[model samples]
Target: MLIGKIENWTKERNYAHPVIRRAIDFLDETDFSLLEDGKYPIWGDDMYARIMTIDAKPRAEQSAEKHERFLDIHYLLNGEETIGWQSLACGAEPVRPYEEEQDYALYGALSEESLQAMKPGMYMVLLPDDIHRPGLSETGASVIRKVVVKVDKELL
Candidate 1:
């Protein structure tokens, strides 16, 4: 998993995939405040983004999910949240098997997990091997407006 401020995207773009760079460029140019909550297609099914405003929950109420077919680029537009992450190689038992239609599998808690607080202008990139539990709050439930860009693995 990778985490950074969106303001540094210009320099970070050099190390990112071309498609991811395009996604970052699109994000930099768009006004998320004007976008309604919904899925917006960028490059057909290969890449797309979802704008959502939801309430944060406790970590215990969230599940660790990993995707095999796409990388998740989570960018916060408003509010804040604490995301939990653990490496897939840690051998955490899967509570739910992978659902191809959804492209994710839910895993039980890992012995070691890290948490990061994300606020507006911040982003987190979760690869297929990054088991992540998002939407958690450090304090309590709060509303968060964010965009999640789904980049197909083929683009990597």
Candidate 2:
């Protein structure tokens, strides 16, 4: 698992080492007590920067469509979460929106070779082209702390 501050991630590229190191540092310095609420804190113009409190209960399985314009820098604040990831290389079919409230739509089923497990303090940065399924269960339910920082495709 990785933990760190967002400001220290300034020099990050595609590799995970430096970014992961910075995340660890960030977690050590910040007071995450304000994250008890399920609401996300507002940050940036297009970036989704908020502390996510995932409950220790099973969550609805869902995959986010491959985004054309952002990178997802998800940092787990607490507990553990196993996120499912799929590759766009296999080709994806579009689907209807699952929850209009969240503006997230489900993508087509993926080949089994693409899933990944993410635990507490560990983070994953989903590139603009990566298809991801976040918030799943392992041991019943677990609360996960996360922050999603979106990077514009133009910068990548």
- Per candidate, the number of residue pairs that clash is 0, 15
Candidate 2 Cα outliers beyond 4 Å, as residue runs: 1-29, 34-43, 55-60, 97-105
For candidate 1, what is the lDDT?
Answer: 0.89
**lDDT per residue, candidate 2, 38-98, as tens digits?**
4332334443355666564343455446566556667666667767676667676657544
Candidate of highest TM-score: 1
Runs of candidate 1 exceeding 4 Å displacement: none
**What local lDDT score does residue 30 receive in model 1, on the 0 to 100 scale?**
88
lDDT for model 2 comes to 0.56
Q: Tens digit of lDDT per residue, candidate 1, span 1-156?
A: 889888998878899878878887778888987889999999999999999999999988888899999999999999988899999898887899999999999986778889999989998989999999989898988999999999998987
Cα-based lDDT at residue 69, candidate 2: 59
State which candidate has the highest lDDT.
1
lDDT of 2 at 31: 66
